[model samples]
Target: MRIGFGIDFHQLVEGRDLWIGGVKIPHHKGSLGHSDADVLLHAICDALLGALALGDIGMHFPNTDPAYKGIDSKILLQRTYELIKARNYRVVNVDSSICLEAPKIKKYSDQMRSIIAGILEITGQEVSVKATTTETMGFVGREEGLVAYATVLLEPVKVI
Candidate 1:
């Protein structure tokens, strides 16, 4: 068994769709980035990469590259999955947390879980997502941006 931890944050911007964990959410502002800027997905991607001793999301998908502009993050997640599989690893489970003040995430937590789980081909019970507030203390508390942290477990496949 292997364990990896990852974290990501993104600034909020107007005139963009709010996306998290591959699901669009109703919100006034969305994360700004070359990709969909799904902070949660990015964090999970990093955790998966870290688990396999691979470089990182930026190494695989550079923001400086135009091809990734406005790209959906699920593609990145899929690519990450492939990278792990190439190393003969399979996901055991993942636990993640989102930090934001505005937009209570409780309502959409289940939806986010379902979407991410489907992409990972894992049961919802294996992927845990939790949200919390910083108590009006930082960028997330001020609603300027959102942050996510993820920890994942991966198991090495037995070679036939």
Candidate 2:
């Protein structure tokens, strides 16, 4: 099995929609970026790419490109998974964490897990999504931005 880790951060600003794990949560501030800026999904994409030593998300989908402007992060995740499949590898499991100061996500966790699992074509049990606060400490605690971390395990696809 191959293990890969990834982390992403995005500043929170007014006017943008808050999206995490493909779920749009009600919040006063949203992550700012070229795309929807779903931190969780971005981290997962990086982890999957890292597992295959294929570089990070920016390399594949550059923010400088207008094609990716205001794009949905879920589509990015799907394309990343396709890369994994092309290499004859399959995701074994994925564990991820989201750190933020406001708009508690406990109620949305299950939906997030389900969405991510569906994208990876894995069971919900195989995908873990956790959320936490920094206890009023840093950028996240100050509510300036949110961060997400993801680790993924992959194995070679078995041939019949």
Candidate 3:
């Protein structure tokens, strides 16, 4: 099995919609970026890419491209998975964490897991989503931003 890890961070700002793991959460501040800025999904994408040594999300989905402007991160995740499949690899499982200071996400984690699993065409049990707070410490604790980390295990596709 191949293992890969990734992390992403986004600044919090007013007016943008808060999206994490493809779920839009009610929050006063949202992650700012060229796309929807779903940190969880972005990290997952990077992890999948990294597993294949394909580079990070920015290289595939450059912010400089207008085509990705205001794009939904879920689409990015889908494309990333496609790349793995094309390389004859399949995701074994994925574990991820989200760190933020406000708008507690415990209640929304299940839905996030379900959505992520569906996108990856994997069982919900194969995907894990967790959330935590910074306990009033750094940028996240100050509610200035939110971050996410993801790790994935992949295996070569078995041929019949």
> Weakest 10 consecutive residues, lDDT, candidate 2?
1-10
Clashing pairs for predicted structure model 3, backbone only: none
Report RMSD (Å) for each prediction in the order shown. Answer: 1.0, 0.5, 0.6
Which of the two, 1 or 2, has more TM-score? 2
Local accuracy by lDDT, each model: 0.90, 0.97, 0.95
User: Pairing residues by index, what is the TM-score of model 1?
Assistant: 0.96
Model 3: lDDT to the true structure: 0.95
Model 2 agreement with the true structure over 19-47: per-residue lDDT tens digits: 99999999999999999999999999999
Give the alpha carbon lDDT tens digit for every residue of 5-107 in model 3.
Answer: 9999999999989999999999999999999999999999999999999999999999999999999999999999999999999998999999998998989
Off by more than 4 A, model 2: none
Q: Between which residue pairs do clashes occur in model 2?
A: none
Taking the tens digit of each residue's C-alpha lDDT, what string does model 1 give over 10-33?
998889888888888899999999
- Candidate rank order under lDDT: 2, 3, 1
TM-score for each of the candidates: 0.96, 0.99, 0.98
Candidate 3 worst ten-residue window by lDDT: 101-110
Give the per-residue Cα lDDT of candidate 1 at 34.
93
Q: To one decimal, what is the Cα RMSD in angstroms of model 1 from the true structure?
A: 1.0
